[model samples]
Target: MKKPLSNAIKKIILDNIEFSTSHGFPNIVRSESFILKLMWILCLLLSSGYCAYCLTKSFQDYFSYETDTLLRFKRVSQIEFPTITICNKFATDLSRSNEVTELAKSGYIKLKSEFTDLTKFNEFFKRVDYYFKYNSIEYKDRFNFVGFDIDKMLLNCNFNFKECNSSNFKLFFSSTYGLCYQFNADKTNIRKISSPGKKAGLSLELFIGYPSKDYDLYKSYGAHLFIHNSSTIPSSEFEGISLSTGHETDVILSKTYFQKLPKPFSDCAQDSNSSEYIHSDLYRETIKLFGQYDQKSCINLCYHKYIFDECGCYYPDLNINKNLTRICDSDIGFECYSNHSASYRESKICIECIEKCPEECESIKYSLQISHANYPTPFYADFLMTYDALINNGSRNFISYSNVKESTLAVNIYFDDICYSIVEEKPSETIEQLVADIGGFLGLCIGVSILSVVEIFDSILRVILLFFSKRMN
Candidate 1:
């Protein structure tokens, strides 16, 4: 049996194996000197082992899912202007100042008087909830009723040298900063700016009225602003740019677009249907309330879920998206929130939301270079004051220059460059590269090509067929 097998192997190597690697194996079969045979066998084994190792490495690299970044600079005639959301640091109107003051004072008093007392704690919260309900803060029209109206905040607005007004803005309520106004948020027709200078972009004259006595809760000194995509929701409270009351803020913007590989190459969402995309109930609710899914909005939604889960009721300050009828009052729900207040303070504590909400494969972002100058010089101040008092008759629609430095904020937002960057993620080892690597390694180590592999397989198949024919006979 050993003789027949040896003969068959020798036949295959001598007659069929045509590659350079066949030299060593055939030499091992035919050599008379034992030392020469041993040397040939060792060469064959070593070369084959290295080839196997190289092929294995190539396969491992292919499966590793490594990524490479490709950065490209692109120049366009025009770029879409980012959505701008402006929120008053005060968040409430001066007219409602007394109401806000009384509510806050009453809330503090109730908490101080009844929170620690187990007997009155729950009942105190019930009354606080009643007060919130009476104020209609949790009602569907709460934004219109509670937050500062945008018409009053936007004193003058011009975009692309065209006069823009309240009609150009959409109202949205922020839980952290009461009412906010968003510009260019409509995705269907986002406004684009062609020129790249302060004179060619958006110019705004804002009147941030005096802060209320109860302004401690709002926690801002000027107008909070956000720059984001028109398709996405803005988290103004977390990452807003603050404009000082007396200064002109010029935001020089540089746009950068990002595109990432999906699925095997990366975990980023490919589209709305991707498994990595946010699919949580809170995320869906956010889409229904807001327009699209954003990581910041999803995180806020998760916090809302946490609030409901912990207090057994939704907090009145947060948007109510679920069907649950219970809203937290200052008594029980507020106390529960206060207990976990540290965790709620930072939205990143919502780990599940962070992990589940994969980033969009394609997104645009603007890097801002902000600079400030004193908004109104004495001459300009006098001019504006005269204009408001005499020409406009102190029209509430324009800035009240009674205290010009304290009441006015001028902002200019524009792109600094027409050229933008496109950052893309691509696979480091594509299938073609992997195949080439394998072939190169195989040829370098064992001097074997595709024909060599095919020849060996053909020999093996022939031997099997011959043996089966003999068995059948």
Candidate 2:
């Protein structure tokens, strides 16, 4: 029985082997056509080489780094017109002789040492009353003085005053109480303290700040001053007062950002003839995204609005209405200003409002150099000889009234040394494109589709399985 079974299995296996050998491979290979075989070998080599080359090229293109042009910086010239505010530090009772005397008599000699001779100072004492009156400092009372509004001062400054010549700028002035004074000069005459030579006549030390606030903002600031001789000033006053300006020690403006890019990309970034060249549509869109409010102005206004909403009144320093309906009473105003000022600054609305302010593309920062000289006023030159004649003729006010000397400010602004570069993400080829390239290369070289390769493999596997099954039976 075992011999018969074994013989039957061997016969089935032999038949299966014969069938597979005869049918599995195409008849073309059995015919041994040399040209076809050579073609097949060449196709295999070419297809593999071409596919490898395509894949390598696709990978390089996908991973390679390239400069992005769309988001680059443009090298365009721009003119910046800065807002100017002139703040006078002539306020505080310490500036007045009476106040200094009271402090000195109280045994505060340390404070007394800081005090300068009030009689020698013309601008601080003489201008204090006028500044106070102009700023409406008396609105509160003798005891409680509301903070001075530097913004309002800038708004109300008489640009047409006897001196200013720069038509490209706007000017603002603060009252005597606008800033506190720390006397650095002793009892020395004005000429000894100022800048030397003919370039000096009246010098002004200008401190610049932005988003003008109270005393806290004025600390740790930047300052710039200018010296005016007879040539620079329109007025005849040979002596100028040294004044402190701005909300801080340093002149502050909106923060600026510079976009740096490669030279080729920057060259063609914008068209000068286009209306939106300097301020592009993209910038406008960004502005709209932030709710259409100018960043700094919006924040300041929001703070003011918050104060009004909470206290049912506006701060005295603000330009808001001072009527019974809107203005806080002196007591309430001081309390609210003192208590809620900090809270309002830290509030969410304030933070959001400031955060939404658009960034400036460019800005200028400047400092002042001051000097003094003894230049005869053009108007007073003829009057020098006539003073004796006037005295002989009995003119009492002529000697007492000294001619007012004005100062000239010269500002030179230019770009800084820092370079900025703009960058963007590089785009890459998709995986689908890479696959297609590889497939096309294989097809063109081998005359074989993906389906053809799969079919060939399937036929070989089936032949092997059939032989094995026959052997087992």
lDDT of each: 0.71, 0.37
Counting clashing residue pairs in each candidate, in order, gives: 1, 23
lDDT of 1 at 341: 52
CA shift of 340, model 1, Å: 1.8
Error of 2 at 107 (Å): 26
User: lDDT of candidate 2?
Assistant: 0.37
- The runs of at least 3 residues in candidate 2 whose Cα sits more than 4 Å from the true structure, single-residue gaps closed, are 1-81, 91-293, 319-325, 346-349, 352-473
RMSD of each: 5.8, 18.0
The sequence of per-residue lDDT tens digits that candidate 2 reaches over residues 321-357 is 3343465554556467557877876779777645543
- Candidate 2 to native Cα RMSD, angstroms: 18.0
Model 2 backbone overlap count: 23
